[model samples]
Target: MAAVRAGWRRGRIELRQSFTNRPELFSHFLWPVLMLVALFFLRHRDFGSTGLLLGTFALPGILGMNAAMGMVSMSQQLTADREDGTLLRAKATPNGMLGYLVGKVVSVAGGLLADLAILLIPALLIVDNLALGSFGGWFTLLWVLALGMVATLPIGAVLGSVFTTARSQGLLQLPVLGLIAISGVFYPITALPDWLEWIGQVFPIYWMGLGMRSALLPDSTVVVEIGDSWRHLETVGVLGVWAVAGLLVAPVVLRRMARRESGSKVAERRERALRRVA
Candidate 1:
């Protein structure tokens, strides 16, 4: 109980700071602004004879991609904290890692939601044919978003635990970018080759994007999707499976990583960083 409360407070404080911090605020809005500009140019374009506007099809996908980026952010944050001895400090305190992790989920998830609003508000005005005006639409959106977060965040923590340095965290970007490219974030996965589509379908990002499209885009847009159906059950199943796997795997990995945290390791890391700078 105490740990949860402490983590909640820490997360709130961190969230507040992120809003006030100039650079963080700038980053929060910059990506969304650029994406919106891209959508502006694409709003008039059609996706073949399907009669679906490319931008309308992509808006939901973009939202899903942004949601998935929360994983990257969480991983990077863990690496940064580990490098700077934050994890060591937490290690010295009882239940501190629990609080730290809880705080991270709160702050990272909250920031992602805020970024969603930044994109969604202006997007709703520009993109036509979204199902935003209905109760069922909003209900679907809520569940998909919630499930997407749960499915991704723990996996992110697992990634964070595996990477030992901030530099190693950079390596994570290539695979994530590749995943985004194939996950149907910027375009349709069905347009890709069969092998590529299979690979993309194996990951949660594609399903998240598909689920979002199903919830928001009109039924006519379904033709661009595989099987000319939304595949809502598939989306839920895949994401749910990943969620279970992550929940099972993350705790073990995080505990192992946390167990290795010590003042000496942090000092060694600092010295190596200084040597590189020198």
Candidate 2:
């Protein structure tokens, strides 16, 4: 409990510093805000239809997109920590790995939540007459989407554990690109070929898109059919089996990656660097 509290304090300090440093760049979040405005002018009447489709369903989709962004960012930094012996130094501290991880999560979650806010402003401002009849469902949607995003945290940690360098995780580029392509993120899932549908089923984005759509839009038969039939489940059931799968697997993957790190391994990396410089 004390460790978590200390982690929280450290995490908040980092979060504050980040906000202070990036205030201007963060203000550019208005891009999404402007996008929603532009969309409103172009598709005001279609609020219940296309605009909502893009804005509402896509809100969670965009949030999920941040998961990929967050995971990659975390992985890159974590790899650097391992290479520089930062992880080893932290582990030796009384504060421990748990504090370090919790601090990281707190920091990452703040950035993600900010990104989510920017993504949402467009949907809410532009799409007037938003049926929002399912306000109750929306409450559930927020948590489900949050859970889905949280599920990706482990992916970032696992990636950090396995790859010694961000460059070493080069293989991730292929799947990450492929995930956005098939996950119906910027485009529609139905547009893809039959064989390709099978491919996207493996990742969290596909499920996040479905779950997000179910939360934002009505349970109509328009967009999804190939998967667990999110429309049929009602409310919380919208997330389906895949979201559950991510939550379950992420922690296990993280533990495995964490175990692979040892003081000797980190020290060896430092030794190589010193030899190279000398």
lDDT top scorer: 1
lDDT of each residue in 210-236, candidate 1, tens digit only: 888888888777787899988989989
Mark the regions of model 2 whose C-alpha exceeds 4 Å error after superposition. 23-60, 128-134, 167-171, 221-224, 227-278
For candidate 1, the lDDT comes to: 0.89
Task: Give the lDDT of residue 64 in candidate 2.
Answer: 55
TM-score of each: 0.95, 0.71
What overall lDDT goes with each candidate model?
Answer: 0.89, 0.62
In model 1, how many backbone clashes occur? 0
How much RMSD separates candidate 2 from the native structure?
Answer: 4.8
Q: How does candidate 1 fare on TM-score?
A: 0.95
RMSD of each: 1.5, 4.8
Name the best candidate (by TM-score): 1
Model 2 has an lDDT value of 0.62
